[model samples]
Target: MFKVLLGVSRWNFLSLTVLTIALAAVTARYQGAEIQQLQLGLVLLLALCAHISVNAFNEYFDFRSGLDLLTSRTPFSGGSGTLPQQPAYAGVALLLALVTLLLVIGIGLYLTWQLGGKALWIGIPGVLLLYGYTQYLQRSPLLCLLAPGVGFGVLMFLGALWALGAQLTAGAGVIAVILLLLCSNLLLLNQFPDVEADRQVGRRHLPIVWGLVPSAKLFAAFYLLAYLLLALAVWFGLLPRFCLAMLLTLPVFLLLWQRINKALQHNADLVPALALNVLLVHLCPLLLLLALYWSNTATV
Candidate 1:
């Protein structure tokens, strides 16, 4: 049962939340904000619960909608396949979703109480996206494309800044936009292999609405824009020099782009592209986090 719950929640994917939250914390530190250990811990718990709730909800809803059975499971895209295999545990998945959502609400409310109403600016939309993403938002192509990025980049990242009492500096805003582009592209590419399955289930994501080739092109454009923004931010002194470490992934990005183009152009396998997308999604933030921490520790 424990293992099943973990599977339904996509426990391995929760590390993305950890990386995001850590990046926010380090960014706050870089900006000279004093981090409170207790508040940081609560924020981490809140983010984790939010992520778990979304994953479980997605698992239950996809299974209920028959999308789970239809999808060709992949390492990056498709449903987690837990409920399809363990149908009896469908109820458990729903329960876990609800319970985790409630926990998210409780923690969010507490943080709002301590941090003031500004937290709601991030919390309200986060809760909405968490609940509506797999169902309602998935029906709108543009909304579906942008929702994941908004949730992670704007809400989670900026909300962490609020909790840590950090000012929303220009550099942070640039970082947020970079994250937004990366995260949106992350979901965009993952939707490729699941395009047919998602369409059958009435999901109107970019891949479904724009078709794979255009969607692939958009994915490439987004990544290019994100890297350009990163370079601009550093050049303009919005981000530190060490943040340039992210450029080290440029070769990998080029390879990923080639793989994605090949997969789309020649109907080649997409697993490698998907894997590289996930790696970049995680790696970019991780490198930035380390860079921010290093900047904070370095003496001027």
Candidate 2:
């Protein structure tokens, strides 16, 4: 049951939230701002609950909507395989999702009252995105790209910044936009494999709405945008020069891009690309975290 819960939570992807929070915290440190450990812990707890809520709710909704049965489960795109095998767990998953969402709301309210009302600026949309994405947002082609991107990227990053006692600066704004683009592209690429299943259930994700080839082209463009924006940020002195460490992931990004470019026709062909993309997602933020840490310590 624990293993099933882990699977349903999509624990692997939860690291993205952690990395975003860490990036914000590390950025705070680099800027010589102090973060309350307790506050940071509460922020992380809320993020975890929100992530699990999204995952579990997604599983429950897909199972109810019959999308899970139609999907050919892949290592990446499909809903967790737990529900298709154990249909009885559906109610439990839904309950878990709602309970966690409430916890997130409670924490968010506390953070808002403690930090600033700006927390609501990020929090309200976050709650809506989590609950609506699987049902309503997924049906809107543009939102299918933007919702996850905004929820994980901009909202979480900004929320973390506020929690860490940093005023939202232009640099943080740059990071938020870059993250939004990266995560949006991540969802865009992963949608390719599930296009058929998603279509049957009325999901108009990028790969479906734009056609695979165009979406692939845009995916490639989004990758370049991430790097381009980072370079610009560093050049403009918004981010530290050491942020160039993120360039280390360029080779992996190139490999994934090449795979997507060359063989997008076959789902099998895109698997390695998907895997590489996931690695790049984690690796880029990780490198940024390290860069911030290095910058902080070097100056100290």
Which candidate's lDDT is highest? Answer: 1
TM-score of each: 0.97, 0.96
User: Which TM-score value belongs to model 1?
Assistant: 0.97
Question: Model 2 clash pairs?
Answer: none
- Taking the tens digit of each residue's C-alpha lDDT, what string does model 1 give over 209-262? 889988888888888888899899889888899999999888989999899888
Off by more than 4 A, model 1: 296-300
> In order, what lDDT does every prediction score?
0.89, 0.84
Q: Name the best candidate (by TM-score).
A: 1
The worst-scoring run of ten residues by lDDT in candidate 1 lies at 291-300
Report the lDDT tens digits of candidate 2 across residue range 126-242.
899889989898888888888877887788987888788776777778778778888888888888878899999888887888899998888778778888988998898888888
